[model samples]
Target: MTVPDYPRPPFKPQQQSFPGKTDKMDPRPDHGEDSYVGHGLLAGKKALITGGDSGIGAAVAIAFAREGADVAIVHLPTEEKDAQRILELVKKAGVDGVALACDISDPELAAKTVESVAERFGRIDVLVNNAAYQKYYESMEEITLEEWTKHFNTNVHAPFNLVRLALPHMQEGASVINTASVQSKKPSPNILPYAATKGAIANMTVGLAGLLAEKKIRVNAVLPGPIWTPFIPAGMAPEEVETFGEQTPFKRPGQPVELASAYVMLAADTSSYTSGALLTVSGGAATL
Candidate 1:
């Protein structure tokens, strides 16, 4: 299919508080609501995604449902409206769908969320660790210890905890997909804390792939570059948001729907031989 002409910047200047609402975005992100079509790639599978309320996670949820997987998406309590909308789309694909409200930064909460999903689905064939925390800071002095820790907790530690908690439900042929970032290799000083966490996630993905190889499970990560999502407005300055993805050769940020197929390919049974891979989805940008 021909790629649709996705919106390009300079976007209308906008800003939002942490955990931005989808309805608030100017051109809005496309979570494959009308475009994505499936062909039973994951029929009868059960998958769980963190931060599935908006952005990449939501798109993956929609794609997974269309592909015939039962999906449970995790989101913060404050994102219920967005979560519900995604869940509605998921169910519309004629599969089981649920929205789990939990702050995965807390180990206990993360564990409970895993247990709840496992109980509801009976098994987890796919785990997508997509939730993340990021905020741009002009200098190191502007980043506090609390903010630094929050980044690790939400981005790194939470994925680690979820993997540990969800493994029991995952068996042979299961897949684990982490959302690493181009920032992992090409770090930006402004969001150093977030970049650092993504670096850790990329490393963790490789390590876990090795460790889980004996169990016949595949582990991988997707390093996305400058996607147009609620994350931009929420984590960036209004001025920065206006020109979000101009640095890329594409001259625009990607839409959330654009990353859907990467997640689907990683989770599908056909990719059984794929593991320890960091698939970069940046539009014409190079990463180490």
Candidate 2:
């Protein structure tokens, strides 16, 4: 199938309440519903992805399935619509896809989610920490302590919790991929708390890679720039959304499908020697 042209925006002004719905976007974000073609790179793998309900997580789930992995996705119950859509696409790859609804910010629940997936799959071959929470704020004061704490809980601590529980179930050749962001290097003042959490994620990826190296478990991260996803509509101001990816050298926001290849590469045997690496899919944005 021919890939659609990368959208150069003059995007229509839009906004959605937090945790946006994929179907509601004016020009729907593509999750390789028609473009990506896999090559059996991850065949027979058992994978788990957080935030697999939409955006990059959904794209990765679809790609991993196409590459022949049975996938289990963790998402909020409210996102059942999006999760169902992703699982349907995964099934097209002839692999089973299950969506587990639970708040991963709760460490206890996060641990249980990993255990449940491991129990179902027998073992986990790939762990993708792709879920995050972010909302724009005018100033530091605008970010309440509760909001700041929630940001760390969801973006930073959840990954730690899941990894701790999953480590025992992960054997040699297992891979853990965290979704870091360009914001980790280029901090955005308006989203200070979110950026801080991303910085922690990037650092955590490096530390975990070294700590887990003895067990031969590869740990890495993908740092994405501005990608066109429901996250933008739900998290940013309408004016910011209008020109979302314009600042990047590519003059366009990346599609979620664009990041799937990097993910597949990291999860596949090809990257066995690659760990503590940050694969940037930032559409030409510089990272520190």
The number of the candidate with the highest lDDT is 1
Instruction: Please give the CA lDDT of all the candidate structures.
Output: 0.95, 0.92
- Among residues 3 or more apart in sequence or in different chains, the pairs in candidate 2 whose N, CA or C atoms overlap within 3 Å are none
TM-score of 2: 0.98
What lDDT score is found at residue 36 in candidate 1?
Answer: 95
Worst 10 residues of 2 by lDDT: 1-10
**Residue 73's lDDT in candidate 1:** 93
CA lDDT for candidate 1: 0.95
Measured by TM-score, how close is model 1 to the native structure?
0.99
Candidate 2 stretches greater than 4 Å from native: 1-3
Q: Summarize candidate 1's per-residue lDDT along 120-159 as a digit string, tens digits.
A: 9999999999999999898889999999999999999999
List, residue by residue over 31-125, the lDDT tens digit for candidate 2. Answer: 89888888899999999999999999999999999999999989998999899989999998999889999899887778788889988999999
Model 1 ranges with Cα > 4 A deviation: none
Which candidate gets the maximum TM-score versus the true structure?
1
Each model's TM-score, in the order given?
A: 0.99, 0.98
Cα RMSDs, all models: 0.7, 1.0
